[model samples]
Target: MVVLNWNGADDTIRCLHSLDAAALETPFRVLVVDNGSSDGSVGRIRREHPDAEILELPSNLGYGGGNNAGFRRAEEMGADEVLFLNNDTVVDSGFALPLLTVLRGEGGAGAVVPKIFYMANPSLIWYAGGEVSLRSGLVRHVGLRRHDGPRFSRPGTTGYATGCCVGLRVGVVRALGGFDEAFGMYAEDVDLSLRLRAMGLRIVFVPSSMVWHRVSGAFEGRLLRKLWLRTASTVRLLQKHGTPFSVPLFLLLLPLRLVPAAAGMFFSRLRREESV
Candidate 1:
């Protein structure tokens, strides 16, 4: 398993603890890639989780670079598969086995993702499966904010596998050259999923494997920055995979989509300031 950390020591340490607690019948190792965190995250994580293998990068390499580093390290360590997990998530004890089983049994599967729930409200789903529309340049998570139920329990092939907690076949991903670092952070997962699909590999969703994510924990209190990165990455995604009309359509609908989100953030900040 690979968990990328970027100046978020507390969350990373908690994630490590959860991994230590996970019930996996197969042997595995945890690789924590520190993305040049300036907050002394390396020292803290090393001190807290002595058994985890730590790969320290010189500077913040964003999401793709950091995970790419971890992928390489995992490859070097002779791992057949790699699970890229977010630093702000807690996994269910049985999460690992289901994803591994599906990845191994499904010969066409390039990647598999576990069902994700909001850590703040564990019953609320964050991502069950994902869909990417090249026609509209939109990436939608199936069952977002919905209550977990039988409808989401079925394991099947999906359009995309979210980076939050996706298990990947190392050989397949390495041959595809890993994630496009040009994406930096946002939409990189979508780009990877698209590439995997283009290669005739299925992106499977295994609901039996589950995780609880502190949604957007990396961008907490930084709404504008998050919005900017997401917007830029979305445009880049459209350019790479969308039809010519898709980019134009996305830009045309930008204001319709962005304005309300920006307004909500603005009001939210004002309300917080007033409360202070």
Candidate 2:
């Protein structure tokens, strides 16, 4: 398992503790890649989880670079597969085995993703699966903010696998050159999934495996920055993988989406300030 840490020692440590307590038949090692955190994250994680291997980078390399570093290390360590998990998630005790079962089973599967729910409200889904529309340049979660039901219980292939808690076949990912680092943070998973699909491999979703994510934990107080990164990454994604109409459609719809969202945020902030 690889967990990327960037000044989030508390969340990272909690995730590590959950992994430690998980019941899995397969032996796995935790590799915490510290993305040049200056918050003493390295020392704290090292002290708390002495057994986990720590890979310290020189600076913040964003999500792709950091996880790519972890992938390389896992390859060197002779790992056949790797689980790229967010530092702000808590896994179910039986999560790993289900994903592994799917990944190691028959057919050509590049990756397997676990069912993800909101940490604040465990019954609400964050990402049951994923969908990508190249024509519209829209990538969305299958069951965003919805209650988990029989609809999400079936195991099958999906358009994409989220990086939040996806288990990948290391050899195949290495062959595809890992994630496109061009995506600093957002949409890299979508890019990777498209690549996998192009290679005739399936991105499987295993509902039995589950985890809870503290959604947007890393961008809690940075709404504008998050929006900017997401928007820029979306543009890049469309440029790289979209159909002819994708970019134009995205551009046409961009202002329509952003204007209302930005207005709501501004008004919400003004209201908070006035209340204060």
lDDT of 2 by residue, 106-167 (tens): 98888999999877777978898898888876777898768999999899999998989889
RMSD of each: 3.0, 3.6
Q: What TM-score, to 2 decimals, does candidate 1 have?
A: 0.93
lDDT, each prediction: 0.88, 0.88
After superposing candidate 2, which stretches have Cα over 4 Å from the reference? 23-26, 256-276
Clashing pairs in 2: none
Residue 55 shift from truth in candidate 2, angstroms: 0.6
- The runs of at least 3 residues in candidate 1 whose Cα sits more than 4 Å from the true structure, single-residue gaps closed, are 23-26, 259-276
lDDT, residue 237, candidate 1: 95
lDDT agreement of model 1 with the native = 0.88
